[model samples]
Target: MAKAYWIATYRSIADPDALAAYAKVSGPAIAAAGGRVLVRGTPAQVYEAGLNERTVVIEFDSVDAARAAHDSEAYQHALSLLGEGAVRDIRIVEGAEG
Candidate 1:
């Protein structure tokens, strides 16, 4: 099975308290969903296109695993915290096979 990855950028963080609260509540939820956060708060030096403030990358065993994470109750609950916490752009991409 091909590994799956998620690339996301957070925008419109109007409330830092909400972000912190959500992170506190949701951080572990992501781990429970069988996803690994590869990158978080890494500096992005974009050569082209616009840049976003916060970036996150997650990896899963396969596309199915990635979907499972999103569909899981833990991740779903975590997602709920995004409404007032932050706006995000999320994309799922398949990794190249070895």
Candidate 2:
């Protein structure tokens, strides 16, 4: 099966401190589920109607693993800390095989 990718685009950050807390646990939660962060930062350029936002990309062994990571207790705890802290758009996609 093709690898899965998790993409999170932060539209707005209301509480940096809370997000920082979320970041702490989120990394380990993802790693535990065999996910690796590929990119994380503000986009250098935007075209069309793209909103300026912080973006993060994570790769997982499979879509099920990606979903599991998001639904795990560790991640859920992290998300609780992030509640109302930021507006984000997140997606999971299967990567094309070469």
Candidate 3:
């Protein structure tokens, strides 16, 4: 099966502290679920129509694993801590095979 990737792009951050709290818990939860964080940061440069915002990418064994990690109890708690802290777009995509 192709590897899966969880991509999150933050459109806006209203509360940095809240987002920080979420990250603390979410990181461990994702690691426990076998996710490897591939990228986490704002873009170094923005192209056309691209916003210079925070983006995160995580690799998982498969799509199912990524979904499970997102729905896990620990992640849910982290989401609660991040309630309305920021606006983000998140997606889980299957990687292309070579």
Candidate 4:
């Protein structure tokens, strides 16, 4: 199966404490679900569209694994902490095979 990438871009953060709470749980949850965080942080620069934002990319073994990680109980707990805390766009996509 092709590898998968979980990409999340945060448009705005409304509650820093809540995001901190989410991070506490999310890392362990992602790791437990066989996910590896490849990139995470604010972009160093933006070339167009004024789209500067914090982003995260996680790698998973397969598309199904990425979906499973998002649906898993531990991640659900993390989501609960982050409810309404930020505006973000998230996607899970299969990576190109080399």
lDDT, model 1 = 0.79
Candidate 4 weakest ten by summed lDDT: 43-52
Per-prediction count of colliding residue pairs? 0, 0, 0, 0
For model 2 the local lDDT of residue 97 reads: 100
> What local lDDT does model 3 show for residue 67?
100
> Which pairs clash in the backbone of model 1?
none
Off by over 4 Å in 4: none
Candidate 2 lDDT score relative to the true structure: 0.94
Tens digit of per-residue lDDT, candidate 2, span 1-98: 99999999998999999899999989998898899999999989999998789999999989999999999998999899899999999999999999
> What is the model-wide C-alpha lDDT for candidate 4?
0.96
Model 3, runs deviating above 4 Å: none
lDDT of 3 by residue, 1-98 (tens): 99999999999999999999999999999999999999999999999999998999999999999999999999999999999999999999999999
Poorest stretch of ten by lDDT in candidate 2 = 43-52
**Candidate 3 lDDT score relative to the true structure:** 0.98
lDDT of 4 by residue, 6-97 (tens): 99999999999999999999999999999999999998988868588999999999999999999999999999999999999999999999
Candidate 1 local lDDT, residue 66: 81
The whole-model lDDT of each prediction reads 0.79, 0.94, 0.98, 0.96
> What residue runs in model 2 are displaced by over 4 Å at the alpha carbon?
none
Leading candidate by TM-score: 3
- Tens-digit lDDT track of model 1 for 1-98: 88899888887787787777777766687677778999999455765666756888899888888888777888777667655767778888999999
